[model samples]
Target: MSREAAEYALRARADERDRISGDLLDLESHTTYQVLKGASLRGSTEQRWTATQESLTTLWQLNDAYRAVLRRAEQIRASRARPGAEQLAALTELLAGSSVILRAAAKPVERRSLIPQTDLRLTLDEAVTRMNAAFREVTSALNDIDAVWNRVLPRLDGADADLSKIHDLESELGETAGLTAEESELARLRTAAVEDPLGATVEPHLDRLTRLLASSRAELDLAITVKREFAARRENLVAALDLVRAAESEARLAHGAVVVKIALPPQAQPRSRVGALAGELDALDVSADPWVLRAKRLARLEDDARKAAEQARTTAKALYGLIGRRDELRGRLGACEAMAARKGLAEDPAVSESFARAHALLWNAPCDLTKAAAAVENYQRAIHGGK
Candidate 1:
């Protein structure tokens, strides 16, 4: 080993040993280690505790191993005060890596190294290579530990399962919903899971997927409700129309019960507004399976049928009372004319005028019962000498 190379190599090994010691001290005081040290580390966290404990044990072992290597390096330098060619050569070589020879405790005895597998002298170039690789194992393990705690473990706890469930349910919705958007979202979520498994991008995407999954579920429910409503709609409308017909029948019966006392000619009946409404309801778009439009049309048809039924009842009631009034008016006019004939006022022009006016009012198609009654009273008063 050259003088400069030897000095630099010794210094590097010593520095590495000091750095490892300091790092060990820092590791013992680390927040994660401290927190775990205080906790029970039971239940779901037992496995994580075991893994972290393994990493900590490896750190301790690395500390010991680095100390041993530093001691072996120091012994080589101290063996010769001057550090002659043999000493310097051995120092540089010993500083090579964990593959160097070491003496057992009883006496200085040669023992093959465990790490590198080969006995070849570790050159200056190999020294740098080994040093770079030295911290790789425990450092990588610590990183893995941190990642397991901070990322992979959290995801395993819920995120992974939630995302998978969302993807599955979204697929189900897409199956019947026939929406391209959900499939596209599932594809995007899968891509995010693959490409950014432990990245910030992934959690946000999973969150977005969750919200979208909820929205899709809501839409699915609406579609189901709309379908159920549509399936039952025809029957519902038919039932409503039946109620309308029953109500019409009741109105007709009511008219019948009252018409016997009225004693007036039967009024001409109008066309069935209820029948026209039923025809409109039957002509609705029940064939096209247009859910949204069909819902609107169905609402309109129901309203129309209801209104027609109500109007029919109202017209029947008015006709019943009109017939009663017309009959009553006819009887009153006859009584007034008879009184006038008996009192020698039957041929009077006043009697004819009052009778004609009353007849005109009561004989009209929708006879004005109010005016006919009033006219009949006027005739009576005139015949009774304004008494």
Candidate 2:
């Protein structure tokens, strides 16, 4: 190659350098381009950021290579003009080089190799290629940034909405009168969530918020069931109270109707214990404070009321049994006397004595049921062979 080709090649490199330098300067100056310079990125973002940084560094070096090769060309041209043995040796060395190696880190090495050649056409091509590659990589990084932003933006934006929904759920529980006295930290976190919705620390709580809402819903459902059951129990107590009164009234009526069958007034009546149970039931204040249905107190009260009703019914049965037995004894004693007359036992002294004793026991005041039963059996055996 002649001096003219070397100078022309140098001029061409210089022109291309200006164009690439201007483009790079514009890229560096742009606000959006510079935004992520010092900021740290995480996960896959970090890898992309590192790749982009490396590409930009390489492009900058390639752009600065134009100056380096031009300086070296000038030196080779100067040494070729003089044609000394040593100068020609240096010129030959420059002509032997085919590439312009641009190393940004080694300033001393670059200074020593200032005498570059016109043989760097390959270097120019490679630099342009690296610049295009770097530009494409930067565009890719920008796209990835947009994608990552899209991914997390909804979670960030909906943070407040989710928290508000949780509040609404809790309020619903409050409406049902089932809210527990225990407090949760969810309310306190709401303020922080509103302040920094995208904060890493608060972001994970979105899941917790969802779980809390679900848990509260379950608790509220259970509470509602308990509340309904308690209401049913209260109604049962009232019904039981009515049942008990009816049973008590039935006992008193039975006692009055069969007064002649049994001997006395008080002894034949249903026990006072059954009547006192009604008072105990009436004393239970269903309207009392802190009804505490969650603890099943209402169910306990209902059981007590039911038991009281059973007591009244049992007392009625006992009184009815006693009166019915007295009537049965009178009928049996009359039958025994008729049988004694028919069998010629009426004149028998033993038979007559048994019949008189049984008569006294069955017909008297506060009739001794145990003695009357034995006497009637004795009188029957003496009269008609225990018929």
Candidate 3:
């Protein structure tokens, strides 16, 4: 071999040794130390012994190969004077060392089944899977952060203006003055709703989003807990989703029941004719006849029922109006959630900041949605309420 060839072979072997050593270190950190310690303990499985022995053997072989390569490279460096012969000798030694190390490294690849069959295997496997999921979630969260900084922050140049307008409205409506506890609370709630349509709008779809975020965080925490507690058991995403769906279904059923009650007509009973007759018979008035007076009371009751029915109709109309307003509020809340999702700000820094601002506005000592709405409406009413 030429000097150039000898140098190339030496460099290749050195590179390969470094790469393999790094991989070995990583594997050692992950598994080898634990296995060796487990093997030394009483009542340890035979599989642990086998795996440890195999790993140690591989480690020795690779170390020997690395040392041999270093020795050959040193010899080559020293024999530069005797060109061709020295080069050939050094090249041969380098090739032999490289071949040994490659073969030793190949052993692990060939004996893939050397992984221990033990109770701890399942646990370790589950830990690995959970680690992978956590890595992915972290990556996704990072991406979301990037998106918020890149896309959402730029759009918030008008936030200060909006805030100023909100303040002005508050001041104009005397919301900033000393007020009743309830009034202050309403003002706070309204400011929050206006500032962070995403976080504070809990009436419609935004409420669902808020709930979803909470649910997701809870699930992530639960998944981590389960992974640690039941390491041997695999957690399925489908199962988690099923649990959420079940809870949502139950909630919807309950809500629907409430809605049904709201929609149902109130029950009213007519006076009992038999009871009236009995009372009249007990009186037993032969001259004036108590029955005649009973008939007049029955006529009066019929008139009262008719009047009540009319009032009920009016009550139903008023309830329908309130329902419409409630639906509108729900729709607005939904729009806010959808907007946040579209902007990818539901869990990002910008959204979090917005939520904080909203909380400050709404949750200050007392919370009041009505006063805040009035404050906001006063300004809008002055500018565009007529329109």
Q: Candidates' lDDT values, in order?
A: 0.60, 0.62, 0.42
Better structure of 2 and 3 per lDDT: 2
Candidate 3, 127-241: lDDT as tens digits = 3233345434433433433343344333232333334444454344323312244234444444444333223432443334334434433333443443344322212322333
- Best model per TM-score: 2
User: Deviation in angstroms for 51 in model 1?
Assistant: 55
Report the candidate with higher lDDT, 1 versus 3: 1
Tell me which residue pairs clash in candidate 2.
72-114, 72-115, 72-116
Q: After superposition, how far is residue 127 of candidate 2 from its true place, in Å?
A: 64
Q: Arrange candidates by TM-score, highest first: which order? A: 2, 1, 3
Name the lDDT of candidate 2. Answer: 0.62
TM agreement with the true structure for every prediction: 0.32, 0.37, 0.25
Off by over 4 Å in 1: 1-226, 246-269, 327-374, 377-387
Give candidate 2 misplaced runs (Cα > 4 Å): 1-223, 229-236, 253-295, 384-387
> What C-alpha root-mean-square deviation, in Å, does candidate 3 show against the real structure?
32.3
Per-candidate clash tally:
0, 3, 8
Show model 3 residue runs off by greater than 4 Å. 30-53, 96-387
Lowest summed-lDDT stretch of 10 residues in model 1?
100-109
Q: Which pairs of residues collide in model 1?
A: none
